[model samples]
Target: MTRVLLLGGTGDALAIARALPTTHVYSLAGLGRVPGDLACTVRVGGFGGIDGLVRYLRDEHITLVVDATHPYAAQMSRHAFDACALADVPLWAVRRPAWQPQAGDDWREASDWREIVECIAPFHRPLFTLGREALAHLHDIPASQHWTIRCLDAHPGNARASIVDARGPFDLAGERALFDAARIDVVVSKNSGGRATEAKLAVARERGIAVVMLTRPALPDADRIFDDAASARDALQHWLTRP
Candidate 1:
């Protein structure tokens, strides 16, 4: 039987975990509340580094590695690639596609925090949807710029901007209301490309607010890459059954 180790964080990770056979083990970075009940064996927290991961794979006799981490989890993904190669285990990734701009979208593309900070300089009230992990890199942005930041977790009390602790699946009407309330003049976000957090882009276009959009980091090469759970499941079935 093919013993599988799934690196999980997103909904796709959980979905794939549920679909795979009983030999699978699901692991998370334990960044948030240890998510609700999952079907397979669960392990949480970081695996030290590439050395630790390679050791774990060998010790556990894992035959396959599935990377279903969040799009921005480039470090973890790179580690997985290196570790799996060292361990001689096949690896695959499930990467959600990035969002493309539509007509009327007023966007300024940026590659990193420095670029994003520069992009927002002309605007007064800049709303940052870059999440808690990426927020620290923006210290260079002048204190004179009034900022509004949103994340799933609470701010650390030292934050200079107004922070909103919330999760999303945000809609256009609600996002518009949020922008009005915050008096947001410009928006900054990563191009995570999912329906849940996409409302702000539409609202920004409607309001003619400029958006500083950060592109996703380049993905590490994998044996196979699937954008959805069904396709990943089909590929897994074939691999697991192959002679």
Candidate 2:
């Protein structure tokens, strides 16, 4: 019998997870919310490391591995790649495309947060969609700047920064309201290309605010890579029927 292991955390992962058979396993790192509704078995927490993951793949008899993690989750994705290769099981990745800058957008690519701070020097109010990574830099905030960070986890912001705990699939109107209310003059975001959380980019364009985009980290190659969840699910279904 064919068994699947889904390495998931993003919304794309949830979509693919929904189509999984009861025998397959869906794994989460216990970051945000664990869905109480997945028909497939849900495993929380890490697999220790590459050695541990290899043991799990063989022990669970997982024939195939699907990586539907976030684009920036390079470490987890790397572990999956190595573990699958060691276990001699095929690995497929749901690798979403990165966003491209459109007309009227003032976009600057930053290699890291230090570069981001330098690029955002001219802006007074900056909206950070880079999640909790921004929270670490609250103490570094300049006297002339105010920071707004949006993340899945809720935290009472410090004196210089405000944290907006919310999930995505955000609409343009709401993004506009957020920008207006925050008096945003710039945005800091990762180039995570998806409809969810993309409204902020559109709003940035509309308001003519500069965006400091974080460059995506390099990911290890997989046996197969799917750009979308639906296609990955379809391919997995086909794999299940293979002799």
Candidate 3:
């Protein structure tokens, strides 16, 4: 009986958890609302660090690990890589495909948050769709620049005056309404390519607003990499069936 440890925090993670064997345990970082009941046992919160994860894996006899977290969740992925290696447990990563710029999409790629902050001075009325964790990098933005920031939770930060507490699955019409209402001059967003939040990019293209897109941080190489939920589930099943 190979007990599994699953790192989950996204829609893909949920889907994978649902598909996992009953002996597996699902874990979340406990950042957002507690997820609905998963198919397997669920645990929320951090695993301390590499040492903590290694201990848990050994103690619980976890034979396999699935890293199905957000692409931006580089720290957790790194920890999982190291911990699983130390514990001699197999690990897999499931990544959603990133959004590529299409024709007519005015995308300016920034290597990181520092670069975006440095080059974004010209765009005064900016709309920030970057997640809350990345907001700290924009603290240096000049106070003169009025920013429209959106997040799932209310962020009490001094860098931005306008903060909208909202979650997405945002439609084109809603994005258009937000852009028009905000009178946005530019858009700054992470290349977190998924259907849940791509509407703003469409609206930006439609309005001719410049977009400063931040590239995703690199993740450690995994024993396996999957681009979709179905493929990942199949791979996990194969691994489970092996001696």
Candidate 4:
């Protein structure tokens, strides 16, 4: 059985774990909440840094590594690339492609969190999906404006908002319910492109709401880069079979 290390958390990571050929799997997650019935063995929290990860790769005798973390999770991706290079282990990045708006879609692209805040202020009621940590940016906007914020954790910020705590791959129905309940007029989100959070865009389109989309950061130099679970699994199999 070949030992493989999966950098987990994102939906793609979980998907890849299910698709792996072997049972000798080691998964890492940064979030405290672990997915139930994940196919392989799991480890939570950081690996210190590049040096720590390199040591882990050697100590675990990991044959291959898959950088299947969140697209915004740049630090871990960089560490994985560096550590794999140091350990002479094969590395691959599974990144979902960014979502592009079709005609009649009211979309505005923002470069960062600050820009997202600025873009939302003029709207009467904004639905924010920039993550819980970013709720602080909403403070710049007054409480007079209605805002609906969705996140995995409860938001602890000064902004007066109707916070919805939920995990996603949210469906259009759920997103539409939230939007309707909140009377949302605008949708704000990171272009953290994946099917998981795509429902927000669907809801926005259906309601004819404007969307503030954040751009994704660049990826590191990877031996193989794939956009979906099947491709990622095939790449992993190829690497594992290579002499």
Q: Of the candidates shown, which would achieve the greatest lDDT relative to the real structure?
A: 2
Candidate with better lDDT, 3 vs 4: 3
RMSD of each: 2.4, 1.1, 2.4, 2.5
lDDT of 4 at 181: 85
Cα misplacement distance, residue 12 of candidate 1 (Å):
1.9
Q: In model 1, how large is the Cα lDDT of residue 193?
A: 80
lDDT at residue 121 of model 4 (Cα atoms): 74
Question: Which of candidates 1 and 3 reaches a greater lDDT?
Answer: 1
- Give the runs in model 3 whose Cα sits over 4 Å from its true position: 134-143, 156-160, 237-243
Candidate 3 lDDT over 1-243, as tens digits, reads: 788898987777888888775678999998766656666888999998999999999999998899999888999999999999999999999988899887678888888767887767887878888768446655666876878888778876564557888877899999888888878888889887778899988888877788998888999999999997779988887878898
Give the lowest summed-lDDT range of ten residues in model 4. Answer: 21-30
Q: Name every residue pair that clashes in candidate 1.
A: none
Q: What's each prediction's TM-score?
A: 0.89, 0.97, 0.89, 0.88
State residue 110's C-alpha deviation in candidate 2, in Å: 0.4
> Which stretch of 10 consecutive residues in model 1 shows the poorest summed lDDT?
133-142
Q: What does candidate 4's lDDT look like per residue over 155-207, in tens digits?
A: 55445667787888799888878887889999888788778889888878876
Clash numbers, per candidate = 0, 0, 0, 0
Query: In model 2, where do residues sit more than 4 Å from their true spots?
Result: none
Candidate 1 regions with alpha-carbon error over 4 angstroms? 20-22, 134-143, 156-160, 237-243
